[model samples]
Target: MAAIPKSTGMQGGAMAEEAADELTLLAERHLVQPWPMSGSIGAEARGRIEGGEGIYVTDAAGRRLIDGPAGMWCVNAGHRRRELAEVMAAQAMELSYNSPWYTTNAPAALLSGRLAGHAPDGLDHVFYTTGGSSAVETALRFMQFANNVKGRGEKKLIVSRQGAYHGSTYLSASLNGRPRDQDWMDGAGEQVVKLTCPNPFRRPEGVAAVAFCDYLVAEFKDVIETVGAERIGAFVAEPVMASGGVIVPPDGYLRRIRELCRQNDILFIADEVVTAFGRLGHVFASQEVFGLDPDMITFAKGVTSGYFPLGGVMIAGRLLEELRRSNHSEAMFAHGLTYSSHPVGCAVALKNLDLLEDGLLEHARSISGHFQSSLKALEELPLVGEVRGMGLMACVECVADRVSNNPLTLDLEVGKRIDNHCQELGLLVRPLINMCVMSPPLTISTSQIDDMAAILRRGIELTMDDLVREGLWRG
Candidate 1:
């Protein structure tokens, strides 16, 4: 409830140095740099968030703005849910931490049971981790171990879609399809195979709906054939590509991929970090959106609404059997973190789920139709080359020429200007290359969504005018 500060960092803002001193010091010292991957910390490139509530974050300058990106598409239930905070505080007081190796807590048990009820069938067993990246790492490691235990030791290589973002950790980053993210790692390319991302908006001009699905299927088949089916461990992917510019796979895309994985005896790991916990209408996006039958589902972000860091992989019944059998031998999965399934985090996650199911999930689902319709309306805008996304997540691709759908020459500046204008108008959004994305918290009301869309439309209009003034667009 205190006065919030201006959001600095990636999104720029004007704030006095003295008020931001604490954030600067923290970033300079303990914050293990992320995103940029250079591990470079710019003093001016930081935002001191004093606190947050509902659909807005308050900065050190006591400014509150709508959170359009749901805090990087994680906080589905919004921020500062009092019940979750209370549950976490109580858990911290009673049992701050516990090792899952020998001691299991009520919070983890209850949370797992609740998750089982919501996630797709067969994805019932839970393996807790500290965050989404770890959840991804766990899925890969589990796949490898499970394969070996099942007498398929050669299944070691994992396949992921191009433009997919798994996480930024060692294995997770390796699994990420981003070229720049993998280029920094010496041997990331060796472990993971990248396939084409299914972009319905930019599908090959003449390809049929089924052809688009077959394109990805054929790509997977070719990769498996090249590597040998025995050499494949798992196929990791997002139910709906989130960080990779929000690419939504066409209708049959997921069904075909699921069939391919099943036919090949390869594990299918759904990285639902951003798509889980009611972000996509259902509890898990893979189940609700794609109707997927994955061997493992990695989750994080919205589990606790960003109130605390917690993530895990939900193991299918068959995979759990393999894990159980493997545990009998000396070759144990042997994967865990100190903060894995922390009591406080698990408690917070349980409470967060309660809040989400109480009405937030339906709230998000109810508005997705309206949100997509509004985004689709922008197709008439000459600068909007493509508008794509589903459920609560969506993006608008900005272009200089509508006919060719070519990216603007000054795409970066246009993107930055759009973001700046939105901030100036009390709305926030996430920018991915030439695309402007919105993933407002599931708790956002219809009226709030209207405000978000209006501000974003204004931002886009302003950016387009700026482009014209600079002689970028033909019109």
Candidate 2:
């Protein structure tokens, strides 16, 4: 990796400041940012990231900050890799566009074969999409199509879990179980059933982790029994819930769920959008890390290291063969995106895969212990209730008190406070309600990890002081 560029006092001085001001004004006037509140819907001006390289990004103010969230948990191979850029440009020059509807491209075909080789046994087919949401939509649609052709059209109900973040598309978003996700938005709630989040930390009071796992499995079994397995089509879950604060389920929880899905004949979809592509030190984590043989696996994000929008579903060959052998074999699934199998995206992904295969995956694995333990030490702080995570991802959950382990109220915005402090000290954090998530680039060194943790420790200490001075927190 290259040495991260140091922060120089705002480049171009007055002119740069004026340009930034102009850009912010322009955005406020015309840009509609995502996940905005009604008050700030179209007028919100977010921090502008000017550029990035290695494990750091330069903000518009010319301050170099550690890319802590790794650009929304993508950018697995780090930023501004010349090789990735060159491959994308070369592929575009060779063959810019090819319609998947009527034609195929070399990059797409070759990449499919390569991805299939990385996927679990029997999952030999791929259906490309623009991103994670569309990939999940494609998987659900395929399940519905498969059941309809087999005369099981009534089996359309989807099962998901609390604290899971699948996607933003309608059907996919409906599967999201976070409380704030559906606060103002409408979804197909009637078609989806959600189970308890398999988080041991928040499990019912007095329940042990081992028993919590059993309770989770038992709850699913009861749902299957009551809803009737015949009415359910798919059970979708993230191996490690990402946006829902890096909720890693109890041991054997996923395998048990897979067994239940198998017994009930429900399609098991592993939404590996965040856990795949070297995030968990593997190309895919469903079977490799969690010991699951899911019927379908949806992946995005790190697929192209966020260099290009690319995501897909890995389908089991047996499922496709079963569809082929059915009487309605000629039926079309009738689903696909215009950018499906995009040559440019595939080319970028191929190069990204090369980087991961070379040594990035090993690097991630080698440093994950340091990455996790460094964050885990933050639990010593009074405001921290828990610091839980696995692999390169982790969450620093803040609470009102340690004994109660109760989350701080929304007004505190503790996570945001920590994030603001961390940013000022040269690190970026993904703030959830009262939690801060950190998943730095895979190339982050042990020393960088030390710097990140040190800055975060100081940030939390500062936040604690602020809260105490405001009379909001005793500690």
Local distance difference test values of all predictions, in order: 0.81, 0.92
Q: Please give the RMSD to the true structure for each candidate, in Å.
A: 4.5, 4.3
Could you give me the TM-score of model 2 versus the true structure?
A: 0.96
Worst lDDT 10-window in candidate 1 = 1-10
TM-scores, all candidates, are: 0.90, 0.96
Best by lDDT: 2
For candidate 1, lDDT tens digit of each residue in 412-459? Answer: 666788888888787777877678888888988888878888888888
* Window of ten residues with lowest summed lDDT in model 2: 1-10
Any idea how many clashes model 1 has? 9
Model 2: per-residue lDDT, tens digit, 370-429? 999999999999888899998999999888554545544632478888999999999998
